[model samples]
Target: MTTTNLSGLVAATYTPLNDEGDLNLRAIPSMVDHLLAQGIEGLYVCGSTGEGMSLTSDERRAVAEAYVQATAKRIPVIVQVGHNSVREASQLAKHAQAIGADVISATCPSYFKVSDVATLVQTMGEVASGAPELPFYYYHIPSLTGSAIDMGEFLLQAGDRIPNLVGLKYTDTKLFDFQHCLELQDGRFDVVWGCDEMLLGALATGARAGIGSTYNIAAPLYRRIIDAFATSNVEEARRWQSKSIELIRTIGKFPFHPAMKAILEMRGLKVGGCRLPQGRLSKADAASLRNELEVIGFDVEQAGGLAPAE
Candidate 1:
């Protein structure tokens, strides 16, 4: 896969669904437009925020295709195709490439632990082989995956084998290791940070791009942080970053996925509730969240409405 580095805020999108948890294909267009209006740099579809693991492979494919079609190449779409079964991930990657996805990413198989670096590399290689023309990114979120392998070392060992191995979605909070990964091969990789609240810290450590679930609804706030940092306004950047952290904390009071969906609904897009195993927000809770958001200055009209980061 040929690769390019992406910068600024990339929103890890939610998979829109109906009340019955079925795919809501019609929601994609408006969702795309909304994100664009919010100044998101790109979309990371079928990842954790999108409930990739909860959806069937067929559903994931449909969601991926829908997002790609809706985006219409306005911004790059990075589809997460990781699965416990290597073959399934490869199949998904093939579909992503076939549908014109800009990039492909995969998390480590968490069900049956991948024992060592070589094995992990071999597994990811199989998935990349299926789509040789697209840039491949490893999604390293150890909290959920529990693999906890040294990411910097993983890159050193696997970077050469996976010909199109461009970089990773580094979600762990290990700054030392993260800095080491960025320094690898004289900083050849595109190591986008994944922690939303700590983005300022990541930027200080040299992260050029970041992907986060909150960016879907809070991109404008973060754009201020990025801009403030660019202009060396540490105090202003800190203020926005603190506000983002507070918003996340407030939203955490409710069931995570449902509350996030509700926030979007409150913002004028009724993309609907999450699937089974993930609960839904009540009208009362949605109203309360809106009130809290307003208190925190989550302007629906201006949410993520800043100019795109240069």
Candidate 2:
């Protein structure tokens, strides 16, 4: 099998919107610069961080297209096409393919739920069929989808059926299943880790690529963690990873996406706040979060300088 390796930091990017909650397509250029400046390898757009489920299909397509065009093929852009409806997911997948996204990923249908691994395979198979030529990854984020089908079992059965099945965006805490999926078929698939706080642990267990929300602001720190590990500086890696945990713990105090967008704004990105259902941080709260992040050693200016050498 010819495997694809999407290693290093693949940021699950936030969809930039204006204060009015409309798509801010112009922000894509700067967003791309911010990510590239940190030496981030690629982007996972319209995923959980991008609030894929919250937007309309047309909105998702516009967001995906902006990212793709802004990137101009500089790096891989994996567009999350998952929806509660398989047909909708397939349509998004086909749209992603048409827009030149590097890969397409989908989570399980949460409302109806996949009754079993076979059903999940069928569900995902339909979505993947839309973009038959593109690599497909199952976004196994059971926390949000609430469909905790064993990934190992899913892969075992689905691997043969989905011709474009490449791997999974392993987001659940099931390290055992993650390892099983990683080692399965002699590492045939790319199992990109998702949980930011447990990233070091996942790296220890053979996770090469990682996708997360925090990567949008903290890519340089995580890149250092990866670099430290590469040089066998385990202690140094642990220190950097610890900072990541602290950052998440602090930001998670508010609504996660809103808090994150606040941080980006504080850093001068102006990516705007989260839409309703995700409330915005007040001026006081935003100020406090900024102080907390600064105390944690996040230097907005220096982040770009910390990117790994090419």
Candidate 3:
């Protein structure tokens, strides 16, 4: 099916939870407001950043609905429904469509590991079929999925098999492969860049949009990069991209997602810590992170236009 391509920054949002690790659905509205205020163009809910795999079917559905409702059609909300079980992922895709998600995306089953391109196509096709009416994007994050089939080949084959297949959230750092996907069939697929740090490289290779977690905490910085790139200010773009790498590296020192949630909390959103396996940031670590970010010139208010949480 034909669909409008996604452009600009789409935040792979964090799923808010309470102190007990239960879904804190109440926090989604303010999170959406905060991202929009920071100039995010779309919301990608239940993706890796949102701990989609860590959550159960019921919880994923709840999180998707909350984000979709809070966004209120002001921006597109692409729900990521990838699961180990293709059936479950498809069910989530159907639910996403039923709940009014703008698009549906899924990763190949990670546990069993998709063995080849054709198998990968069949797997994703099942998931995309669930939301037949909406555009479908294959979440091609091979690092996590361990299914490093040639994406260029996969697209060539899946294009006809998966009718709703629009493009990919190309996450790997292979610029050549990414460019191949972009130029495939006269750029038929709307391949969105997934690596936040390599966005400038992707742009040079013709990326029109990016879906990333850092955008939640630092959209303004990235927007400057986009603006500089668009204006052909190569030096300015590099400067901004370097700052983004610095910010990401600083957050990387701690538990990444937890540190991100802490930044959001510092900025006034009640986005609690991540679930187990990616646990919460300790108060001491949070304070230390604050100092580190300050040294890097990352003021939450200035960086994201958010007021400090009371």
Candidate 4:
């Protein structure tokens, strides 16, 4: 596997949909353009933000293809192929490699929790082997996967077992575990931070990159956090991070993903609301969300560095 690791803000992108909740593949190009304009360094398609688990296998592949094609190599597209089935996840991985995706990531099967590090490693190995040509990142999201196995142990054992295994997309709030994984094997793994609000803490713990949902709406703000931190301006970095927390909290007041899609719609992207269970934001809720965001001084136009639409 290539030794290159993801750096900067990688957006765990949204799966654009129509009002009917069908894949609006046509919207992907503009969505990608918006992200690039926002200074997103990479794209993580079909992750939690993208509602990957909620989609069918075919739908997932189509979404992955649309993102890869839209990106057109301007930046790396990391496809998250995690599924409830290991075999299906592997098939998706193979498809991702076939379509020339830069990297592949997968969460362990969640319906039946992976019992230990060995099972987790084996499960991931089977998935990663499907795309042996690409680097593999095991998505460590304990809250969603219900498998809170120690990542340090998993990585240590997986290093030799899975030849293509590279790093993790750590989404938990555990700073010490994250730090240990980052420093393990003398930083052998590319541990991209996944908690948006805790990014400042991750940076303090030596995170070089972050992948998250909030980055889709506010990459410029997070970029400022990174820049300030790199320049040793801790106070400024904390200020930006606090703003991020405010934004996230405001959105969290409603159905988080649907509210995020609504924010994107306000910004002029036709990204419809999320799929079932997560559901859509009501008209009233959307209006209230807009008001809340305004009260917080969130400039939808300037949120991602986009110029106001004339």
Candidate 5:
């Protein structure tokens, strides 16, 4: 099996919208750098947490382009180009490659109850085949995709069917399957944790990385966890990884996407509020969030002034 340097213990951030509800494209690069600086080895460009399903195709393309240009070869950028439309997904994949995105990943298209398993596999297979030049990671989040299948079987078949397929983002809560996939597909694929809450457990398995939403705020914890483990500081890594999960509980309690945006807004980037149907944080909620950040040793006032590094 060919190797790809794409196991990403990454933070999936929301695309900030202005108060006017337009995407704050300008913030893309710095947010990218901030995560990388905080010791995120890699990042997933657009995911459910990114409001990817909420953005228009043109908006998605523009965001991907901005990330590519801003990073300027700084780190790997995995663009999430999955859409309900296969053609659109393929188009986004092609565009992502053209713009110099390092890897391409997509979740299973969730239109209905997933039709059948083969259809599910075939859909992603098409994407893998389409962007044969770039490595692809299959994203598994049954809650978001409404489909379930044997990940082990999928990877076994995927290896043969898709020449460039290299990884999996196991997001579902049932991690035994992820572990099984990790063991079964070991050396054939890189398995990244989709659920941030269980990152340490994922890391404990052969799985070495993650793609999570909460890392946007508490990236320091991620760094410590990985570094501690690298130095064989298992006890320290466990403590830090547990802290990472505990920190996420508060952020996770907040309707997730918007709360992350509010933190970014507090950081001085004008990423917008969630459009209608997605609510913004109330002032009281924002204040409480700030307080929580302080409890976690973050300086809210200082945070408001710093620009997220590009």
Candidate 6:
């Protein structure tokens, strides 16, 4: 979203569920500590990567509150309270603010299939109006929403009407569209590349932050990559980015949530397992992932290791 908190690396957290498919509020404090210890710049909770689409309204809000309390002001937590309903989004945003979240973001309403520019703008405006004081970002992933909003008008209107319109967690695969977003909103919005594949290209064009599912496993490496690049260590950054992408490709091979959880368990975090619908990673898949992880310098022991770059 807009404001000083929007810039830098914000990991879209994976919602950790308990065995009964309930929200795992207790696991958050250690998770937040893990991320903070790795130098993660920010966090986006209850978003797509966090399994927001699958959680009930109360479960999602509870997770948001847990995250806010767990983070304990160590870093910014951007709560994603988007839903298919406007009232739901408004209520969740209010919840996010009440829980002390640094920012609140929402995606365009999905399943309606209304692709017209007018309709898209109206939907975002309604959500923004609901949380008038909070900094908001358009969760622009055409892949999930089943409908696409025009960034040109959205960005333009966001600039004018929504004073707290901070940025977009861009998920549209096309760099041209992403670039157009940066160009149109140039100085006005801070773009956070939601997709892992586009991080380098996004960084090239001045994307201020990255909000990705993969960052849960690779935050330290990302921290290294971003720091290297910012300090003009272009070559080192290239090395880190290449390694990062290689690791991402491995995680991408499986359903992302379980794969991430598997990695955590392998590391001995005792983070527990993914609930059904998302399900557990198959045994074969886990082994293959284990191998892939080892290749990228991640080992069973290294998973929860404190070596920093080990």
Clashes of 6: 2
lDDT for each residue of candidate 5 in 205-288, tens digit (9 for 90 to 100): 756777877777666666666777778878887777666655566666786677777787787666767866776888888888
lDDT (0 to 1) per candidate: 0.88, 0.86, 0.92, 0.92, 0.75, 0.76
The weakest ten consecutive residues by lDDT in model 3 span 301-310
TM-score of 2: 0.95
User: What TM-score does prediction 1 earn?
Assistant: 0.96
lDDT of 4 by residue, 205-305 (tens): 99999999988888988988899999998988888888888888989999899999999998899989899999899999999998998788787755553
- Candidates 3 and 6 compared: the better one by lDDT is 3
- Residue pair clashes in candidate 5: 9-210, 16-272, 17-271, 17-272, 18-272, 29-310, 30-309, 30-310
**Candidate 6: lDDT over CA atoms?**
0.76
Tens-digit lDDT string for candidate 6 (1-310): 3357466667788777676667777888877777776567788998877888888899898889998988887788988878899888888888887878888889878877658776766777777776677788888888878876678677886577666787788886777777777777446676678777657667776777888866666676777777887898778777777776777777888987888888877755555566567787878998998887777676555522212332
Clashes of each: 4, 0, 0, 0, 8, 2
Better of 4 and 6 by TM-score: 4
What does candidate 2's lDDT look like per residue over 1-310, in tens digits?
2336798999999888888988888988888998898788999988889988888999999999999999998999999999988999999999999988889999888898676898899999999999998999999988888888888889989889999999999998878788999999998878989999988889899999899888888887898889898899989888888888877898888888999888788767868887778867899998888777667666654552232222
Evaluated at residue 127, the lDDT of candidate 6 is 77
RMSD of 3: 3.0
True-vs-predicted CA distance for residue 24, candidate 1, Å: 0.3
lDDT string, candidate 3, 212-267, tens digits? 99999889888988999999998888888888888899999999999999999998
- In order, what is each prediction's RMSD in angstroms? 2.7, 2.8, 3.0, 2.8, 4.0, 2.8
